[model samples]
Target: MSSAALPTSALAISAAIRSGSLSATDVTRAALDLVSARDGEIGAFTTVTAERALNEAQAVDRLRAEGSKLGPLAGVPYGVKDLFDIKGLSTLAGSKINRTRPPADADAVLIQRMTAAGAILLGGLNMGEFAYDFTGENAHHGPSRNPLDTKRMSGGSSGGSAAAVAAGFLPLSLGSDTNGSIRVPSAFCGLYGLKPTYGRLPRTGTFPFCDSLDHLGPFARTVGDLALCYDVLQGWDGGDVACVDRPSEQASQELAKGATGLRTAVAGGYFRRGADPSAIAAVDRAAHALGASEEIDIPDVTRARAAAFLITNAEGSALHLDNLRHRAEDFDPDTRDRFLAGAMLPASWYIAAQRFRLQFEAAMRKVFSEFDILLAPSTPFSAPLLGQKTMMLGGSEVPLRPNIGIFTQPISFIGLPVAAVPVRVDGPMPYGVQVIARPWREDLCLRAAAVIEAAGVAHMTPSSL
Candidate 1:
């Protein structure tokens, strides 16, 4: 089957499969063929589970023949970041040392949820080493290139997840966001990515980067697809202590509201600073579409970002201390150095950051009381050229890797749900704006994103590749 003949959206694909217009096995094979033919240019998949995928697709077809009821995501093809366990593959987490570990005994909780929803898993994706870096330059596995422009970065550590959907290989993909992994890649790749409220979705069976900050969510070309995947993945899981025991709140039905009666504001002060012209314009466009004329300052966001940094460093370092002690040579030098510094941090710093984090969350809760949505730039700039380091920020040159998450970290620090919507621009590359909402209010974020999307201000652009 030609790529052009396949349905581009998850819902459409699922409907076709259910209606017998497309067989699950044929659709799955076509998607695998596309990955095999073009993924080399983008390096999105670390392992393409063709045999497993075909087997699953055949199962779906068998069920259909038996006249069984199908789930919402029946026959929809997708992939996940390498950190998620996949039953028989080593969960690489984008590290060379992890290659020595035994294959996983079971799939991650989210993967199981997707399978139960009738979604077919295509493979495991490439990502930043141990989810530490933001540039998507994996030292062990080759970097996952931007699908729009292969020469540019795809953004990390969920770079491959973003690239796969943007490249038209999949309609949906799962990724983790400890610090802007989902949003950064979404911004760069021109896709809608949801960084659901922390603890909103279960993280069991996924390799840990920062237990305190890590969040798993989905990437899709459309807001509807993102909402569908998120709703299906929701519910409590005892395996992950961080997973809150909350009832599943579906957002797919909330899209029709479209920012109606919602008090929206544009984030000013810290968020507006250090951004390129295009990045700020993207926020302005989204805000205008959402009727967010009011601008509000989030106090001490700079400090909030610092606290997030400390928490991430300390937690990530502790989890990998054993690996750092022994197989240091197998580690990616950039990731290893960050983990080393994190290990040496005084315990008091982590404690102080945790204290300040509570204060930050409280402050944000108050701000949310006044507004239903806050719009901010997803990235300070579009995708940077691959392997090209350093960029100008705030009238001075700054290291590129750490600064990419400047706008996103503060929001993530407080565990708020955010929908990163790609904003249309005149340039070749694309950037995005974050539609942020209060904790457990992913519906509001998705609603605001739908508003922007309906206005044609935020939508995914096809990749040139």
Candidate 2:
């Protein structure tokens, strides 16, 4: 279990563990040592649960000793975004106000499942307060510095998750995508991140940023690790109303099918409208790998973005109505305005946004009827300055953090599966692109992403101080 033998994928870790060449405790300890050595700069985890992770690692090793079956993720250690509820731990959601909150009563379903599969939970990671922003710059928790470039932003609200994996602290991390949070940071940090079809993973225990758009997923150094986590995490969680009772066979059956003959297109129009050159080039590279055709537009992306904004604001504000009324001062200034702004949105506008989502979903289904996969930039640019609010995108200055959701919103608006691949490109904030598919079509999305990643046409940011 030397750090020299650190795995690049969770599947590889599982193999090592199963063959008695490595133990879960060794993998967990190595991850902790790396975090100890590196996280002061990365600032990925807000709370490092070292003792607990070690205990869990020992438990996993005990499972192996008892001749019990280990899951595909066995012996892997991953950071969890702070927003998810971890048993006996307060679900901070990266907010200062939550300092007084009590520990969780039980583990989130996804956490329990990963643990059952022998994965060790390292700790809760940093994020935008209450998952309100796109940049992983936390005023209270401190910004999650990009591993590739310390001065740049880590894409939020899953910034820490991305940094943790990208910095080699661990090969895998669990993150949530509410308007590209997972994909954006993963792109910036140069890692593989999947925003599975909405509800592909249950949201029952994750803090809600926007109920309509929230998605739970995995971040890793390779597509194979993404699949390993997905297989362990996806299933029917009866408590989560959005969870569809798909057969448990989904991940294993779909992953290696490959993207042969799949009709793919580069998303143009709004998707291409205001993105950085690095972002555009990354998508372009992916297009060539998939043999994608020229630009195809998904109508009304601008309006859809607005609608998504209204809904997110309204829902998020409502969720914290009591807190805003009394403890407003305790909230982070960067996100406080966003929450208060949401509180002022007219109820009627919120209703219209929901109705629009239905129509939007219908329109997307029609588009998918024609194409198998849609390719687009996960973030409009590579990571920006830690507190940056603007960027020159496609010849126009746009709000960087908020506008980062431009390309990702339209696809997630309809509950589609998207596997975001961080292609190697020369930049401070390494760019990444997403391969999106129709709802429940992660098979196609993963296939296209794997192809793009395997081509090695895109450059990956190296981890060096």
Candidate 3:
């Protein structure tokens, strides 16, 4: 099937299946065929559960034939970053070592929720090894290539999730953001990605990166799909200590409300300091669409980023210390070295960083008291070329890997919600702006993003795969 003939959004596919214009089985097969034909070049899938997908698709068709009630995402096909557990597949987490581990007896909580909502899981997608890298250059499995330009890097650790959606292999995918995995890849690959407030969704059964900073969210070609996937994944899970007990906030219903009665601001100072021209322009365009003229400075943002890095290193190192002591060589060299360094950090530094985080969160909360949504560049530039190490930022050359998450780390550090909305331009690759909101206020972020998308300032254009 031609790319143009494929359904562009999850809602479109679900609606067609519901109306009997399409069969769930046929839709699933087309998605599988697309992966078979294009994933060799894109490198998006780490595993494809063909048998399970077919079985689930058939079940959806049966439910439809019986005229039974269906969930919101019925008949939609989706993928998740490899860190999420699928019953019989060993969660590789983009690593060579974990391939030999025992299979998870049950699916991750989010997987169960998605399946319960009638979304078929095709399989696990690739990610950065142990969710550490910003560039999606996984050494164990090859890097997930950008769908826009095959030679450019898809941002990690959610690279596969973004690439698969952008390549049109799937309409939606789940990804984890630790310091910007979801937003970075979404920005680079030209998709809508949401990082919900910390503890908003259950993290049970998913592999851990940094427990404090890690958040699982959805990536899709449109903002509505992002909100749809997020709404379904809501609810409390006692299995996750951080899981917030709350009622589901239907962001899709609130999307039409737009930015009315909301105060908006463009992030200045550190946010604008090192951004490339395209990054700055993208933020400007998004701000203008939302009528945001006030530029607010987020105090001590650089320090927040530093604290986030320290916490990530400390937590990630503690999680992998046993492996580093014995199976060190089994890890990706790039990831292995970083873990090794993290393992050697002083105890006092980690403690101090944790304390600083509370201070930083309080400062950001004060900023939110005045502004409902803050706009900033998601990345300093668009996707960098594959294997290209350095890039020009603010007239100086800097390493590409760590700096890609420069704008994102500060926000996630305080556990704020953000919607990364793609801003398509005539440039070689598209960039995005972060629609940020205060803690537990993803509704605000999605609403502002919906406004930007409705105005034609931000939207996902399918890549020529």
Candidate 4:
């Protein structure tokens, strides 16, 4: 493969390789070249494994020549967020505090699956410390710039994953969504990203911010690519307690039908409020594409967001309990006060949040009974300037981390599958709309998203980075 030819989607690269028009080795080289050229400016990666990628690419080429078998993801180059454990590499979780931790004993289950699928690891990318913050800014590793404009941001804790994909350095990346971590960055980057239903993908070996709420998913240039990665990574793992006995839905089945004949709705309430005008327009455009007519309010969202906050903070504070007690100075200042505050949270409040989860999820499930998919803005606005904090939305002031999750937390809180579609509607900031579906129905979300992408309603601008 020449440096000039890099496929941005699984559909393109897969077909090209199958037909011998493109070789995996060539694609790998091109991807590496992209990283070399643009990553210095974007800070999308915390590490890059050049030799590992080249070796994987060669193995793929051998398989291609033999015409024996090809995994669904053969030859795709991807960046794994630092939180995921990669064999022989220390998992940093984008924090300086974890820099001295020894290399992982084994790859995270999801990482092993991607490797088996013939995806090349381009090394770990940056993220919010301990995956606590919503903004992609890493006070420890420095900020990951938005691919669209170097001056702006890529939504965090999955910012690096989205930036790698959106900057065209890689076609795919792994991200975890504890609360809009994956979707926010994907939206800002104008790329397709999926946060699969909680437990749909095993999280063993992936650092956790919120045990009950964390989900592992993929960021990619297209819904199908996201599906391809999802299919490969999902299934039960005995090592992970959260891994459930759920049958994997066939990506070919849902994606084959595409977006035709799907019932869709535009979400209001939390989703409708506090977004840049362009973000709303993008939602409108997606609704129009899906032929959505009803504009329904998603009830219990405000409570859901509140509950998510309590749970995330509580669990997160516990995860770093020892560190907070003995080595608080080593923690990133960005999340230090927030975690300290959570440490003082009452036990009853945590319990109340759990109780609220059942009520909120029950209310959400009913809404799904009326609609196949729900659409809303991915963020209130595009990624703000690298160091900017506090965004005013719908005439209300909200902190950066919580505000980015405004339209997102309510949906993710209940473990629903969702796809963030990057919308290119005119705005001072670039943002995307999130399309959500009920648990285990990522098919519904991705199918609906494909429609808008096909119509060219969602597209990320090329980055100067």
Candidate with maximal lDDT: 1
Query: How would you order the candidates by lDDT, starting with the best?
Result: 1, 3, 4, 2
lDDT of each: 0.92, 0.83, 0.91, 0.84
Residue 110, model 2, lDDT: 90
Best by TM-score: 1
1-465 per-residue lDDT for model 2 (tens digits) = 556676667888889998888898998888888788889989999888899899988887888899988877888888799998998889999899887889999888899888877888999999889988788899898999888788888888888998888777888899888788888888778888888888778987777888888899989887777876888887889878988888764554565666688899888878776876778888998999888766888888887888888888899899999999999999987688889999999899999999999988888888888999988888877777886777887788777767777887777777788988888776445688988889887778788877887788655645333
Cα lDDT, model 4, residue 408: 82
Off by over 4 Å in 1: none
Q: Residue-wise lDDT of candidate 3 within 335-434, one digit each (tens)?
A: 8888888899999999999999999988888898898999999999889899988888778988878889999999899789999999966686889899
Residue 241 accuracy (lDDT) in model 2: 93
TM-score of the candidate numbered 4? 0.96
* 10 residues in a row with least lDDT, candidate 2: 456-465
Candidate 1's residue-wise lDDT over 1-465, tens digit each? 776789999999999999999988988999998998999889999999999999999999999999999889999999999999999999899998888889999999999999999999999999999999788889977999998889999999999999999999999999999989999999999999999999999999999998989999999999999999999999999999999999998899999988789999999988888888899999999999988799999999999999999999999999999989998988998888999999999999999999999999999989999999999999999999999779999889989999999999999888899999999887989888999999999999999999899998875666325
Score every model by TM-score: 0.99, 0.96, 0.98, 0.96
How many angstroms is residue 392 displaced in model 4 relative to the true structure, after the best TM-score fit? 1.4
Query: Candidate 2: how many backbone clashes?
Result: 3
For all the candidates, what are their Cα RMSDs to the real structure?
0.9, 1.6, 1.1, 1.7
Backbone clashes counted, model 4: 2
Residue 178, candidate 2: Cα error in Å is 1.4
The whole-model C-alpha lDDT of candidate 4 against the native structure comes to 0.84
